[model samples]
Target chain A: MAKSVVEIKNLSKIFQRDSFSVAALESIDLDVKEGEFLCLMGPSGSGKTTLLNIIAGIDRPTGGELHVLGEDIATLSEDALATWRNVHVGFVFQTFNLIPVLTAYENVELPLLLTKLSAAERKEHVLMALKLVGLADRIDHYPRQLSGGQEQRVAIARAIVTDPTLVVADEPTGDLDAYSADEVLDILSRLNRDFKKTILMVTHDPRAAHHATVVRHLEKGQLLPVEN
Target chain B: MWRLVLKNLLRNKRRSFLTGTSVAVSLFLLSSLAMVYTALGKPLENADSIPIMMVRRATGIVFPMPASYGARIREVPGVAACASLSWFGGYWKDPANMFANLAVDPENVFKVQFASTIPPDQLEAFQRERTAAVAGRRLAEKFGWKVGDKITLLGSLWGFNPELTLRGIFSGGPDDQLWFHWEYLNEAIGRMNVVGLYWIRLEKPEMASRVGEAIDAMFRNTPNETKTESLSAFMLNFIAMLGNVRGIILLIGSAVTFAILLIVANTMAMSVRERISEAAIMRSLGFRPAHILRLFVGESLLLTLAGALLGIGGAKLLYDSLRLTQIGQFAFADLRLRPETLALCFGIALSVALLAATWPAYRAARTNIAVALRHTG
Candidate 1:
């Protein structure tokens, strides 16, 4: 009975390369409800990340109505979209794209810098986020000083620090070993279950999909039926 | 934001330091050239207040004029005082200790060249004692000469070597010369009754051109024709002998400025290009394009401003240290780095920062976030 946090109807995305046009996504109909951990599983170049980007307001769709949180994202300007993303959505990339120059604490505080939060409030939020990921002790450590799994945890902390409505991750465990992969997946699962954070993740590993509440497959830019 | 800028600069310490050093050296050279140019014009800055004129042979300064011309020059309607000034090129001990030693008419030199402040008793002693010489304060300090010290000058221009007593030390107005009695040099040179030039002081600054014309006309078409000009024009002719110093400084300054611009532009371009992915990440975190641009520009400003401070400060320190040295005392006696010059250098630094960072920052800001992220991956 949860309200739908994302709604997409007949969405299409086409990329133009010189004189040729390639359809990245065609007539994609998808709905993600609040508190749902939706896993998108597909092969390479199957429009998984393309759809995720569009839903996150990072890229624009070629046609059809696309709405997230009941707002038509396509109608928003670039700056407005960026502001909306800052307030409403969080992102975790596969490569752990934390600014190398910033420390773990500062990296997590990046999004809060855009908000009107005071220094004390930002400190509280950053420390709490780092604590959630069990990285409070490494708060002052630079990104290069941390291990691969730890760096990914820091990225996750940065994503959730702002307490966004939705967290979208693109192959967050693609570069991790088995143990670190499970650790990242466990954290994502905990965020979805305990914090009731809505997560939309793209993955290729079947094991990652096992942690999802609802799983869907895509083939050649078209969505398949949801797996029970 | 500033914290981020600092960290980014520290991220590549070697490159940042090298770029900053280049800026520092370029600005140092540029400011030094400007200081020298300004120093060359220092005498002319107060020339109008003094209202003095120099009358020399029409041919050249090396050609002597009649010392009797001083009496004729003094008779001019607006002339307040006239003195014969003969260059006595001599060295104190070694050729390396060479300075401007002049044989000036003791009775009227102070009246015409009143900028030099000499005590009354010393001025009287200088006029009474035929072999008395007065050294400038800086010249005395350089050679450690005191009052009553007998100094011997080994003349380079004339065959006679003159021994004289230092009667007084004057404090102001090109205080780098030693002045002895012109009558002494006249007698030593077999009573030639010839002088190198005449220094004429006008009763008022407005009478400079009229008095100069009258003086020149008085000696025109005679065996010794005279050319009279204001002190500033005379200094300009003297500087002209140095062979286009202003043009050379401008050329070198322009080349240095352009080179630093290219160096800084290259550095900024490389720095931004290396961080395209990081810029995209920041944009994804809700940093606007303008914010990104400000960040890069702030870094460049910080870098260039630091360099400007170093260069300007270094120039001041270096020149201030040279103020008492032989070269500084003789040539750049009043050399100073003016606040206007410092402000101008700062403006140049700011302009260099903005120009260098704009294109690279713009490219990075306008880069597609998705494409940048993918490309980095």
Candidate 2:
């Protein structure tokens, strides 16, 4: 009986384009317990990413209650939601979106900058995060100077540096080669298992989904239970 | 976060340099304009140090008042110094070599005006010689004359050859004119006396209006009545004759500042536009829209500050090397480009940069994350 980190009740999302209304999500009801590694698998336009965004508080559900860490997503201001997300949830994207200007340590050190941590404390935490991603040796390298796999590891370092309760990854390894993809999945698996971090990952690759403890399918705009 | 801002600048070298240049050029124009404005108006601001002219009440530029009033005006109260000066108009030794020449009282010349950098020995020598002249530094350099050399003026006003020895040459303050002895000239044509104008100096600045009134009132009912004015008023009267140069100068400053604002704004806008995808990525990394806004604004402010530093530095260098004698009467010697002025230019550049960044920042902040992801994908 673990505490639920995310709870969604009758959630739906609608997007308007020029002159047409498109439904991105419809009646998505779900509960995700703390420390559970859940995967949402679907094809393009299947609303998998949309559901992750809603649960992560990056997007609104248009109609219904989405409670992340006990706070309703709709009621939070944009600034409040951003601050909440920084402290409570971490995100990893398909593109290893490291700031090209900053070094590995600095990029990993960014989210901590928003906090009131002392410079020495920030450095210590940043070093530990990079070490966790096995990139402590390349702390001073710029994102452009790092390999694709190394850059993705730095992105991972940045994500976990804040020690957030929930981690949301959308197509996290979609841009990497097999070796890099495997390394990234292994790190994410370790984050969920060893660190006991709750992970909600959206992926189209079956092999990538296999690392998750539980897998859920999304078709068009509805969530379906995984078949045995 | 600031580290990221710094890295972004270095990563895109061409864009950063372009933005920096836009800010630098605007600052350069502003600095130069301020220097010129300060140079031109300096004498007017220090009017207490300079003297005024006494003109005939009804006489205009073409007419002349009797020379007898020069001696009579010397007797007025608060008039610590007085001298009569005939325009002597411009001297042309050759038709091509023309410059200012004035017939002035040798005895009272040193007594009046900001004496500038002339020694007492030279002034005494010039006065005792009777046929001597004290040439301005600029006029002496133009004719290549030494202290004892004789200069012959082919006078346009009196239409005579007034040969006089250059007893010494003295540098005058910003508003100096060349002078030769009036006694020497008037003696050459005795009883044919006529003083072009009388120059009077008051001992205290506050006494100027009172003395000016007394001088005019003393001869108010006289046959050769007079009109007297402060030197600043005379200079302003001359400046007024130019009809809208001051207004035009102000208009030009405004226009230049406006053009600079546009240049800065355009640079910031382009910088923001190119970083849309990057901004989207930042948001996905849990950076709020306000964070994105500050990054863009901070970058612009930094660019403008760099430009302002360069522009102000260049201006100070230019002002230092400049020989103002060749650039008309720049009434102040120290036409400096101040640090505060640089800060102000930086401030203006920064404001323009920030203003220019505002719209793009809004666009970046309110960006539809889903659409941005879709577009990038």
Candidate 3:
């Protein structure tokens, strides 16, 4: 069996909003092995993004141990969790949440700024990351100046610039057109197969699931059996 | 991050400029006005040993006291010297050109009040020449008067242009005054010999209050009963006549501070509101809460500090170049920005920026990343 990069046991999440209690996740027991490409599929309000967020350490699991890279992320302090997220995980969002003011190079260099990399090394890594997304020439362009496809590409470059252990993408191509979406999905598949990154993606599109090694179904706050 | 801060400030030009200009203008006014006030008080501050008490009528400083009191105060044991002066309020060439001129005892003028401030040779020249006048260097400089230059005073309160010869120019005394023989004024006023006030120096500093009381007690129930106060007390009384200046200025400063604080704070809060998503994005990018706090607050401080430097430097250049002297007959005083005022300007800038940025920075830093992301998501 492959080494498990993530292990979850009976995880549950309850959200309290103004005298209303809603369960977002219930009794989720799962494992994401090293170098595995897992895709979670569901309709709206199905907690697909919530599950990915829990694995990314940005959202807390309410009632179970969530171990990522063999460490219990639930037990970490808020700041330690931040450091852990910085060093170990990367995220690609539905909206290409690039800081509009920063250039593509600066945006891609954002995560690595927290590291002890020298300026020269940061420049090299930023250049290579943008090169990977085929945006090396557009590094000086601001977000508003970039096309939607190019902006999402820059977002992907920023996500992997620090070479994190796990990359969690939530609808990474949700805002892209067909051509752009194919380009982004192709890059994700390459990162998983060629670079051996453990990718956990949340998407409703079957075309996105085609790149995943295993696709699971999430419905009504419960993990269903594998769809494919 | 500092680069990001600079870019954020530039992203919204109008709000940033308005807040920065508000801080600039308010502090410019505050610092410049306070500097003028401080300059006005400088003479008194430096007059540590004014050396004499002024005796005035109990009614007011504008009222005249009996000239006979000069002789009586001389008889008092502690009174070492005495000189009586009547104000000679007249101008040459233009009534707008105003300076202090006093009809005083030329023989004892240098002895009682202005001793050692004038040279003995100049005092002798002033005494020997009957129409001789000793003018302060500033007044002489204003009118281009030198020794032996006969300057005519027009519209004297006694109704005569007393043609006085400038016997000497005194540099050590007040730069905006003149002293001449009382004999000329007495004769001009039909030998009335009445005076406005007497300047009396004590034999010892400790004898001031006792001698003052003794002098007033001797004149009790008399028609022109007097009030004798030390020089510092007289200066304080004059300042009190200006009517709660310090209190009013403090109130104005506080109001300006509160106003700027609110304006800048509201601006910063609005900026944070608009960037709620960006803040979450920063956190998701591994920024700790402290980072966000420092970024927002530091941006505010940078904007305010930039404005402070510009305003203070502009005020210094303007005032230093003009040395504004046209403040309603206050010809001798000038407006100047000191080093201390510069420090105060930047200090107020930094403090108010911190005050304005505190709430916004705290709220932005403590923002829930999940909720913020949902708002943006």
Candidate 4:
């Protein structure tokens, strides 16, 4: 049996604007195990992104018990949560949010700068991560210099450069073409299988869900039955 | 970190260059004017230390007094020495090419001022030779004068073109002037003892006002009544004649400094606003708020420092090449920028940079990662 890396019980999130209130997430319950590729699928406004953000430690639930890697992130302070995220969670976004000022190599080295790793060790880890994404040759290229697919590859390299315990991806392929989408999905799947990294991905595409080991659905921020 | 800042600047090279150039120009103007002000004001600061005071006609600086007033001023209590001075408005070659030309009692002018300045041998030679004159090193360099060279002064105060020999070149302690025997002018003008002003050296500097009152009391209600004041006071009179521009210097410096601050601050704010998504991504990557603050402020300071260096360097180049233009009374005659001016310029640059970075750094540091990520593309 795989060990549980993330545990959520009865999580709820409500946002208030002016005189109106909207529920972004409501009473979500789920569990993710080590090295599991769990894909969350749902309709457009089904709270998939909100749930993923909560699990990534970027946003906290209003009421719930949320734990990742044995640490209750809900109990952590903002700075502590940020530190935990640095060491434990990697993130991939739809638009490939790599700093445009930095080259592919420097962008990938961002997370490592927080650690005490020597320059040689950091360079070695970054090179290996880029190699895993099959972008070893594009290390010197900037985001504007690369294609949509190459930019996504560099972003994935940056995400995994810290060897995070979990990778949380939110609509990681929504903006890419069919071929570029497959390239990113291949990298996420490989990160799960070959590197044994736990992945919690939010996707609307059935083809992307096919690559996950276990698939789940969210309706109004509540998790449905999981299918293996 | 510096590389990151450099790369970010290069991202919008034109905008950075334009804003940086403005900072450079502001700093150049501010620093140059400050240098000039300090140079021009130093002599006034030292005026009280010198015991010598000039007793002029009570009417104003332009009015003349009798040469016999020198003897009466010397007899006054606390008066150590006195000498009569006559303005010798001489111009060489072109009438517009003016320099300091004066006629003094060669045997007595040294007893009051320029006493220890000239060599004893040169003073004796000046007293013995009526045609002999002395020039400053700067004047000599400007006109290429040797000790024995004879120069003729055309037109004016004495109403004669007096031909004189160069006797001695004195370092008037950061100043240069031409002085000759009063007898030479007397011989040309046919007036044996008429003069314009008298320089009175006090036994003690603290007795300036008291001694001044006594001298004016002796000559009061009579013709050729005198007004006595220190050298610094006279310099002030000279400055007033040229239209006191200290207020303008301060006003323009403050305006320019404020302008540069706004410009750099606006550029920084715009840059940060455009990088909202990037900052959010960094926050999501687990960079602390303090980290964000450092990056933003550090980038601004680096930008300002670059601009400041260019400005100061340009000013230095301008000063290095400046010569032959003299506008100051005494202190700022050369008008070169000093080390203190450079230090103050950099201080202002650093402080303004830090001040300009504050709001933008705070905004970037307090950015909400979730909201920013949701909104920005």
Candidate 5:
């Protein structure tokens, strides 16, 4: 209905580790509309992670074009790609990798440091993001003081604090218990539905995939349209 | 940002304190040793306190001058007085108390030089009495000498057993020395034909060179050649005998500074490695790689400054309360830390910290967020 926020054409990635070659992706063409909740489902090592990384501009594709948020990331240099990722893509990792040295508020305020925002403004944004994730009270707590689910919430808060266009989550709930996983999924769903943020998630869990408006399956690096 | 750096330092208080202490100790040794070396080598602050002995017109080792030259030297231009001296090497009645003891004309020795520790009345009284000598306070204290005591010295240069009365104990002035009269010394040697050197004092110090030349020309055909130097230059020559101790100390100082640098660098590398995941997380949250690098490097500078302050404080305390006065008349001139040295140490430490940060900061800056997250996860 709206213009696509992420446009990809003939995207492919090859993994070459110590002279062993593996085709991680093959001519993958996809369009993600603005505010869409898209799920990429596949078994482990099926190019789901690679595709997500490429979209996030964290990795460059071996061959093909990827235009995420109107920027052809494949043509950008490493520095430009890093800058682009900072402004356009936010990542949620499976392990909820928060900096152990920093408090939850500092962790969430990290992204704002790159901006020219005043310290007061950065604090306001960080508090709002934490409140959105329902962890405003835990702002001063260290990562070790938080639960697995709470840490993931802080990670998500860090991701959305900058209000980027695309949120790329790579099995964000994989390390949590079922209840915690559901709780994290609920927050992610609310982000998509209420904030109207575009999300591209990689997950093998069917129930986790259920929140996406569109779910695509990848097998052997090839994307297959869902029959349902 | 400064708050963050400070907080991190305070957070790891034990580790920070230990590392800071190591740096402080090394720098303390460096600064204190430098002060000691300077005190030993530099000219005494007061110049008028000691008598000067100058020989004329021969550069190498001082061969024996004819005993007749001593009388002629007494008549040279600007010469207030003169006395012949023989370098008598003294061994204490106990071997461990051995120190420098030279044989001089005892009558003129007191007139030409002042021994601060010796009571004036007693020094005059010792000069009038034969075989009587004033012992330096430090030397006397070392061997436990009393005014009326008798000490035995084994003399190597003149080859004799010299028994002397310790008439009074004397302390140090600008030129710290220990001496006894040549009369008591030469008479005991059973020879009246040899006087090894001449000690001269001038009313006007600047006329010493002309006076030396006039004296040397007076004995042109004599077999014993002479070498003359000002008091300051003679002491400088003595300093040369220690064989580049100053240079060696400086080299050690630089080496210690570099060692501290390496330690700081290693710490930074380990810290950066441990924080790889945090770096990635920050990058993902739209924080630039440069920001992380700054944070890490800033933390290093903070640690180094703390160590430097501790080191400088310790050095100041030690230098101010130096107890080296026990080493005889040699007083350290202005034994306080120079602002320049403190500034130099600070500059060196800061540079070392910055140098140490380069690798870690570059690694953090170049790390790929995607790859970093994957590995960390």
Candidate 6:
């Protein structure tokens, strides 16, 4: 009964290399509803990240009508798309791509800098996000000072600090050990169930998919039927 | 944003310090050379206001002229005062401690060379005593000479040593020269009625060239032909004897500037290359390309600004501490760094910052976010 937060129809992506063209995604039809944890599973080079990037407005599709939150994102300019992403979407990369120069507290405050928030308001939001990830004590610690699990948690805090409408993560736990991987998954699952945040994740781990409400497979850029 | 810039610079402390030191040293050398150049050309800035002229032998300044020509020069139209200045190249203690000791006509020297001011009592004492000498304030301070101090100079040219009493100390003019009675030198050198050159003061500044031409024409075709020129042109000729000093300073400054530019450009390029992945990560976080560019350029700007401060400040500190108003024959009476020079150095620093950061920042900003991320991964 939840409203559709994302809608894609007949989407295709082609990459050109010199004189040759390679299709990354073809005839992709997908819909993600609000408050749904949608997991995208695929082998290597299955256009999983490419699809995720397109949804997050980090990349443009070659052909399709793509709408997220009822806006025609494919028609937006690059600058406008970036602004929209800043306000509406959050991202978690596999490598925990937090700026090494910034502390954990400052890293979480990065996206808020783009907003019209005052200094007091930004600090409030950053502190709340770090506290949500149980990293209030390590707020002043740099990325190099933290463990792998703590770094991923800090990245998660940075992703959700702005309270975006959708959080798209590409293998958020792909580099973590089993214990750290479960910790990251538990946070992502908690963000979905408790905060009602819509999450679209790309993963190769079957165990990660087990935490998703709906899991879809993509083999050679074609989407298979959803598995409940 | 500034915090980030600071942190990034501190990330590579060694590289940043080396780059900054290079900029500091280069700018220091450049500004010092520029100050020297400015000092050399300074007299020309107010050349029109000074109505003094110099008349020497047509052949060269070293060639002596007839001291009797002083009276003829004084009779010329537009001539206010004329004095004979004979160079008594002498050293105080050691030949290495050489300075300009001149035998000047005590009666007309102050009238023609009025830039050097002395107290009324001191002026009278100087003209009354035959072997009296009036040293410049700086010269007196340098040699620790006081009134009634007896100083002996060993002449380098005439093989005569004169024991002179320091009667008074003058305050201005080229404050590094010592002047004594020309009649004393004439008596000491076997009554040779020969003079080195004549210093002529004009009724008006506009009369300089005409009076110089008139003086030269009067002595033309004689046994001792004369060449007369305005004071500024005379000083320029003195500088020209050093062989294109301005050109040499400019060349050295330009080379130093170019070398610093290349060094800073290399530092910025390396910094940007190392952070290419970080730039893409920010881009994915919805930071615009222009923002990324600003961040990179901001880092470079801070770096160069630090260098400029160190360089300009260090130059001022070192020069002020040294207080070297005179070096050899060059007199930099007011040798502080000019405001224009400071502004110029700052402008150079800003320009270097912008030029060095533009290409690297542009390349990093415009790179495709997906490709950059994937390549780094």
lDDT against the true structure, per candidate, is 0.89, 0.77, 0.82, 0.84, 0.77, 0.89
A-chain TM-score, model 3:
0.98
Q: Give the proportion of true interface contacts each model preserves, from 0 to 1.
A: 0.62, 0.43, 0.47, 0.62, 0.60, 0.55
* Candidate 6 local lDDT, B172-254, one digit each (tens): 77668899998999998899899999999999999987899999999999999999987677777777777898898888888
Which pairs clash inside model 5?
B58-B226, B104-B182, B117-B170, B117-B171, B118-B170
For lDDT, candidate 4 versus 6, the one ahead is 6
Question: Residue B191 error for model 3, in Å?
Answer: 5.6
Candidate 5 CAPRI category: acceptable
lDDT of 3 by residue, B1-377 (tens): 78889999888899899988987887787777667556545424434366678888877777877667888889998988998988888887789776778888787676676443666777788999778898877678777888888877777777877889888887654556787888898888788868887888788777888989998898989998889987656666666677877667767877876776787788888888888778888888788888888889988988888778777777888877774543212312444676776787678878988998888788877777777887742
Separate DockQ for every predicted complex: 0.68, 0.56, 0.63, 0.64, 0.43, 0.64
Q: Which sections of candidate 6 miss by over 4 Å?
A: A225-228, B43-48, B56-69, B76-78, B119-125, B128-131, B148-150, B155-165, B183-194, B204-230, B326-331, B375-377
**Residue-level lDDT tens digits of model 4 in B89-159:** 88987897688788887877777774347777877788889888887777787788888888899867668
Worst 10 residues of 3 chain B by lDDT: B326-335
Which candidate order results from sorting by DockQ in descending order? 1, 4, 6, 3, 2, 5
Best by DockQ: 1
Candidate 5 lDDT, B1-377, residue by residue in tens: 67666766666677778777877877777676666556555645444344465663364334565567777778777888786677677787666665767777767765555435567788786788878777767677767777888778874666786888777667654223457777777678675756666667777766767876777677676566666666555555556656787788788887888788877887778767767776776666655667777878888888877887788777877655664444434234234566656776778778977888877877886787667875542
Off by over 4 Å in 1: A1-3, A225-228, B41-45, B56-64, B119-121, B148-150, B158-160, B186-194, B206-230, B324-331
Candidate 3 Cα deviation (angstroms), residue A77 = 3.2
Q: Which residue pairs show backbone clashes in model 4?
A: none
lDDT (Cα, tens digit) per residue for candidate 1, span A21-72? 9999999999999999999999999999999999998889999999899999
Which ten contiguous residues of candidate 2 chain B have the minimum total lDDT? B325-334
| Chain B TM-score for candidate 2 | 0.80
Tens digit of per-residue lDDT, candidate 5, span A137-159: 99999999999999999999999
CA shift of B248, model 6, Å: 1.8
Better of 3 and 6 by DockQ: 6
Interface RMSD, prediction 6? 1.0
